[model samples]
Target: MTTDTDTALEVTPDAAAAEFDRQVRTLLALGYPALSGRSPEQFAALVAPLRAEAVARAGSAAYPAGPAGPETAPAVTGRVPFVLVVGRALAPVERTMPLTTLHGGRLPGFVDRSFEPGSLERFLATEEARPPGRDGVHLLCEVERGEEFCGVVPGDAMATVAERGRTPLTLEEGIALLTLFPEILVKNKCFSLGGSRCGDRRVPALWISKRAPKLGWCWEGNPHTWLGMASAGARHA
Candidate 1:
């Protein structure tokens, strides 16, 4: 398993702060306000309090073990307490912005043409995906790329996650993770956002294609050697 947490780099309070700031700037530069319907100041205000604790919380939490095995967990380098998530309001362009912005115009992120907005809307978060905290824009805690579940069938991965008392990443959460840490979406080791699902077998996933990131779907029962399931430990304000 790859074991690359949020990003391939070690997480320190300083790194966390830098990354967090970068996300804000990136979102604004990319005109996130247009999609999110929140002003830059509003977004800035939401994260101001978090800045105060960045130093205290950074590199403090233990990295949880991956579902495949304990060894698949990354060493305890450091942890960013929260990941700023913009939610599902920008579902139509979530995947594209991250890829285009992060990749430096190499290749734009691709969304399957079949997933028209109406069809994409059907893939709601599973019951397990709901967090006890405010469900709108918020911070996600203990996020992981779920590398241990690589090569595991999406259906089996979901069952394993349930048995382990954890939640899989929703489509929005998955996009948020990638938008903040593009390095996690490397070739031959992509991930599925199994927390969001349609009535049938399709599982939303993010993968690399032509050296670019792609938002697509995979059958629940099929196992792909390149894809693992992404997950988060919890969500909060």
Candidate 2:
């Protein structure tokens, strides 16, 4: 009595193991271990327990895609919780890395003028901004760019997210998403990290600038035609 739907949902042990291995290699290639000050072995050990869970979470269905059109469509929408984002490990200047595919010579990621040293830490420290797990590695499931909310004010969109029982992504989560999947931040489809706030009007966001990704902020009450708030369905230890 095994239906096709049930079969599709079942992940074989081999498939799960393969998924975990791919994630480990991908993170290593992205220099996650160095960013977190952990050896490759240590990093892999941390993520080992969540192998099957990560793969299942990554396969979960996502919300409707935005109107970025096929040209700018993301290869993958949801992040599989493999990124290791040490919030305080490096300054914003050193933390952000430009995508290798960007035109012109290699460029580094930059924080907006509105931010200063330790600014991100303070914002992330707020109880309102605290992530679901500890300050180290964690899992975020069904994370979306919230592109459907584009042109909608962040404050209003957050209210809507709450009504739907979804969680807005934190600053660390946003950083992780960009660090792992730079293609998701294409033109006219940037996202706001509304989950991280300092009890003010500002909402952190990631966007493309001069063919590079930039971590910046915008007014909570404002709306942008291109930037939508990001969110997650759940988080795990």
Candidate 3:
């Protein structure tokens, strides 16, 4: 009886924004160019529109109620499946940093605070949730990230957003989520970086990327990292 619907959560535009901001800041601090600019305010202004677009896309999707029936849909049993959709306008430049290179040799507390609680940690806990073989699709919304700019997920994929508490996302929270889940670090890929705004209103070009696997790092093969991001998103859901 388990279904995607049972695992899916409704998210709002505001909540998406908050998670995006949190993720972006985390990447910047971790030596990732997820967010490169002057001032927190400027960065916030740059990413807002992308977040809004993501929220809209998530809202419009017809996500599964839980695990689909054997004949009705693919069985997404075992660990709950979810997706983390990111939207940016620029691609990340090639760069590798030792653990010591991280600001203070570790992920800052602020970055931790931004994580969607148990999203990443929990998602990586199970083999079924790991990328490349996982059943779900993680979408990315990049303006110029790579060959798959704009939409990262296929048309047949099921999609939904993870909500925090009862409110939608704010810019800060969204960025924090990205920081906790840097798996979006695909090579030759970048997210949107610039946009227009009027007065206090800002327009972010929006970059998008999905959480996938690479061939490096201490925990590169483990699922812990992916689970961490998923767990965080679930908490918000």
Model 1, span 1-237: residue lDDT tens = 223453333346665566567666766776666665568797677555555454455664443333322122232222223566766754344433444423343676777765767877788889989644443565677776776777898999988888878788887777777676565677666889888888998999988876677889999999999898877767665
- Of 1 and 2, the candidate ahead on TM-score is 1
Better of 1 and 2 by lDDT: 1
Query: Relative to the true structure, how large is the alpha-carbon lDDT of every model?
Result: 0.66, 0.63, 0.28
Instruction: Sum up the clashes in candidate 2.
Output: 0
What are the runs in model 3 whose C-alpha is more than 4 Å off? Answer: 1-6, 31-39, 61-93, 96-237
Candidate 3 achieves a global lDDT of 0.28
Residue 46, model 2, lDDT: 68
Model 3 error, position 127 (Å): 32
Candidate 1 weakest lDDT stretch, 10 residues: 68-77
What ordering of candidates by lDDT runs from best to worst?
Answer: 1, 2, 3
* Top-TM-score structure, candidate number: 1
State model 2's lDDT.
Answer: 0.63
**lDDT score at residue 95, model 1, on the 0-100 scale:** 39
Worst 10 residues of 2 by lDDT: 1-10
